[model samples]
Target: MATFQKGILGGFSGKVGNVVGARWRGKNVMRSLPQRGSYTATAKQEEQRLKFKTVIGFLSPLVDILNRYFGSPQGDKSRANLATSYHLKNAVVNLPTGTVMDYAKVLISKGDLRGIDGGTVAAAAAQTLNFGWQDNSGQGKATATDELMVVVYAPELNLFYTNVAVATRDATTASVTLPNFMASLEVEVWASFSKPETNFAAISTYMGAVTVL
Candidate 1:
């Protein structure tokens, strides 16, 4: 049985005979029920599935942040969707071992805002990560008040340490202290800048990988 919110003329949600109706991306959608059978995916289909899954899983940790600053929604696609599409195409790779992310190519945010100049990161004592950049505020679309955003991922633990709005672009330097458990482990880093009051952001830069001290 299907449920309609506004009589027979309105869109429905639920199962009706062989068809399934549901809301998708805010639109009413319908599709036929899958037939009961063992199905094998083609080589291309399998590849696509692996790529999609890899991107989605790799991005799960940053979903909320990305949705907030990655980019503006285009049509029905949200900011998260745009970021996922970008990573799938440019960051995931097919190597002999398997499909995996090229962490150095990842972007935590994407937009028209101008990025910091000479951005750099280094691991420091007490599991702290230090960041520095040449202040390019007032250049192009950049602003002195643009806030810094950083993401640190420790692959061995499959965990992330995110610091948003930790400092403004004009500060030229900032720091992030991770849990003690992260000490001595290798981690990947990325950084970006966003307005303190809006969802707009600069395209993030990979700050290179480092072993925590």
Candidate 2:
């Protein structure tokens, strides 16, 4: 039986050789198999090819959308409220007697008077009259006899007020009458130097104002 099986296998090998010799060299042997419609790639290779194509297609549309949404955009940040600074300048003390009494200048910077609550006299004390008063004799003196009266004018409010006096006696006098000079918002200061019969010459001078931004 072993010999018979060996003989049969040898005959099969010979038959395969004969079929191959009937065809031309290098011709596809697979073409003789029954046709199963069409050839298709394995599942893994097909999935990999699909992923590669998807990646390539995504790039152009992604760039176009980003450019349309974010490129060369306009901004309205210029309309914001701006920081500003102001200082007192050349304040002239116009006495009721028609005489321009004295002139003084004020220096104002942001940090000089920090944490001052708005709309109060003490809040604005950092900007005060620089000394040297003009007396009734028209002499510039370093000191005044009574108090210094200042007339404040606020340009933004278009108003003027009178008798915002700085007392010479008390360095810390912090109260004053709110002036009713103008309907517009403004600030003015004045000092009183004498009582009736006091021969202390009335002085007037300019108190300066300034602003910084």
Candidate 3:
């Protein structure tokens, strides 16, 4: 198969010995076809590939924030790439489950002082929910300031409410006001903490699965 541009002069195709003609990405191109052989990867290889993909997709959008907070790897030019690769390799993807990441664990491994402890949730109002956690200022970790990401999933409506930056971890409790459009159903809340100066975001854990009163 040959890929051609929108207004290419002519079409090109047919296999010329090892090379095959094909059109790709708005241009005419040719490349060598695969040799006759089994193209399947081993089980372990597939598993690793999937893991890499999951990490990449999750962290790609936060490259700048990660680099800024985590700081650059010593003597390395590509700070964003460095953080991404390091976390992807050292991340424990099996803590909460084999496939899903236990969010706080990843952050702690990277450089967080510690994961939020004793996280508690309660309904503050008809549309507001409050979250509180033990202040880790006593830990004396590298970070002095904290931030949070709150994710709420409503199973009854199959909806998700995500607030990437709820607030700085200055206070012990943070409140989240949900949209009125969401169904009044039992919702599961997950939380992750990050330092203000570093990219270390703790692994997110389930806060609770409760119905708002």
Candidate 4:
């Protein structure tokens, strides 16, 4: 009976060992199955985050460069002072009564005054003046007879209206003769009408070459 009992005990132990081994192998196989979908999602999210960061980094530098070129903060005032000329063919004309006058085309030219040489003026001093003088009852007809004043400013030399001229009337056209400003210098122009018109128009003038010392 003792021998029988010993054999039975050995058999039961063997069966238990086999069952445990099989369950362990099955658990490992399940664990090994691909988690590819989860991995792909994670990778995509990381890529998008990196791309967004890169774009933001590039834009930050670009904005800084633009600000520098455009003279932001303290630089703007200094840069404005250095500008050669602030061309003003499209300048708004204000009347004494606080009403805005309509602008017509105006032109400007640079060179020495007629018969004068060696000195130059801004080039192409020509523009048109537009105005309507008549009220609803035809009381006033638009007139181009009023003299137009051309004033020029040069910041480099601290000059104001160093060169001035008047526009000549030609029917509906008006033109001013400009003298060669100091060579190689930037200059600003301003215009005023002797009388105001009811309407305004666009005008342009060419700047003259600056002489370099």
Candidate 5:
């Protein structure tokens, strides 16, 4: 491994022969490319790999939401990466068949902003979800104009239906109507709030499972 003072060929950015070069942090660097070969993973390594795949597959679709509310990035880790690390450690479970995600433990958004109070969700007419929450507008950093964010996932369908900035905190209620294709499907529901005036968000609440109308 080597760091170039003047940068090789003005900071090389690709592979040439056995060496690969790119900028890391703010400095140009070069290193030998990894040799291509087959290697066996240890039991622990394989388990970690499975957990990564499981979490990535589930969270990839929710990247926008995760990026917004998961948490601020630390050094090289982005918010999405932070979210993945968190679920990998806390939400994934190993089973006799394979590593699986526990839906109840899934977090669509995470932050220190004031969270929903007495939140609930239930099936309503026309494939809609009726969401209700007690108004907590004057509580800890909470404001009347903070908007709602909702996420619903249908695991059997492998799809997510989400709404961002849907309703104000004072509204105390909101509804989400899924596509007709989602009718009668059992879905997991979650809710959070974000202040429109700034990049602030509340940790989300999982409102339990409900069958869509």
Candidate 6:
């Protein structure tokens, strides 16, 4: 019977009569306290939470990088939030009976119909990294320009190198120059097709992580 307008900083705790206040999605809300006791989630629920964390850890660092090029289809938030939400939900849920979701692959594709295939990475000159991939745009979809995202982390040094490159749809390779190279580097590569008109990018293909010599 009561609807409040926006523009209020929300913080609510304890209980006021029959109504309890809480903050949700950056907004203040009131609801009746539940009668149930606290309980732990099941094994399957925990597994899904772990999946969400894994997906989030990988994508959080890439938010700035994604926003620079892909922006967002929704506009209100960065594309990274969209990618995270999509994959977190994707980790759970049953498919159409016969279908099975590949969480590993889903982490990279992130729900985009077009994904990279046969991607390979190698150390290119002194501080440059080379990446190559095959287009996985099944049928009917016209081949569009592709964008490449490369993230390199040196565990020993606790360093990260992030870079993005653009390639023609027909081109299968691109390279990025790092600020400096370590003896051994762990790298994760992703690629997505660009919809220039909409300023949106398709789901990215995770090119797998590799240690380069």
Pairs with steric clashes in candidate 1: none
Ranking by TM-score: 5, 1, 6, 3, 4, 2
The numbered model that scores best in TM-score is: 5
The residue pairs that clash in candidate 5, if any, are none
TM-scores of all predicted structures: 0.87, 0.24, 0.52, 0.25, 0.89, 0.57
Give the least accurate 10-residue stretch of model 6, judged by summed lDDT. 98-107
Tens-digit lDDT track for model 4 on 1-213? 011222342322213322321123223111222334544448547544544443333223223222222222344453222111211212223344532212222122221112111212333423221221111111133234433334444446544341222542222233443334444565544443322231121122323323322
Query: What is the Å distance of residue 154 in model 3 from its true position?
Result: 2.6
Where in model 6 is the C-alpha error above 4 Å? 1-15, 21-29, 34-38, 65-82, 89-120, 133-148, 151-160, 166-172, 179-182, 195-198
Query: Local error of candidate 6 at 186, Å?
Result: 3.3
Off by over 4 Å in 2: 1-145, 164-192, 195-202, 210-213
Model 3's lDDT to the true fold? 0.64
Instruction: Please write out the lDDT profile of model 1 over residues 72-166, one tens digit for every residue.
Output: 99998999999999998899988889999999789999989998689888888999989999989888889889999999998888899898889
lDDT of model number 2: 0.31
Stretches of candidate 4 exceeding 4 Å from the true structure:
1-141, 162-165, 169-181, 195-213
What are the per-residue Cα lDDT tens digits for candidate 6 across 1-213? Answer: 123445465456558898787666666677776678889999778767666766665556666655544434585666666666765676434334522334335433233335566777777656666777776544335264555555565544545676554565557887766665564566544555554443444566656555655
| Model 3 per-residue lDDT tens digits across residues 1-213 | 444454555756668788787666657777878879879999778777777876776666555555654544676456567666666676537333455443433431234446678888887557688898877765655243667777776655655677767876657788898878653667777776776545556645567676765
Candidate 1 versus the native: TM-score?
Answer: 0.87
The clash tally of candidate 5 reads 0
Q: Which candidate do you rate higher for TM-score, 4 or 5?
A: 5
For residues 1-213, write the lDDT of model 5, one tens digit per residue: 889877354778899899998889899899998878998899999999999999999999999889888878999898899999999999998899988888778888777788999998889899999889999988999989999999988988989899987899999988888988889899988899998856588888889999988
**Against the correct fold, how does model 3 do in TM-score?**
0.52
Taking the tens digit of each residue's C-alpha lDDT, what string does model 2 give over 1-213?
A: 011222342322213422421222323232222346878999667654544443333222223222222113235311010000011013222334532312233211111111111112322233342333323322233242334443455545544444423444223243444334333333433233332222232332333443210
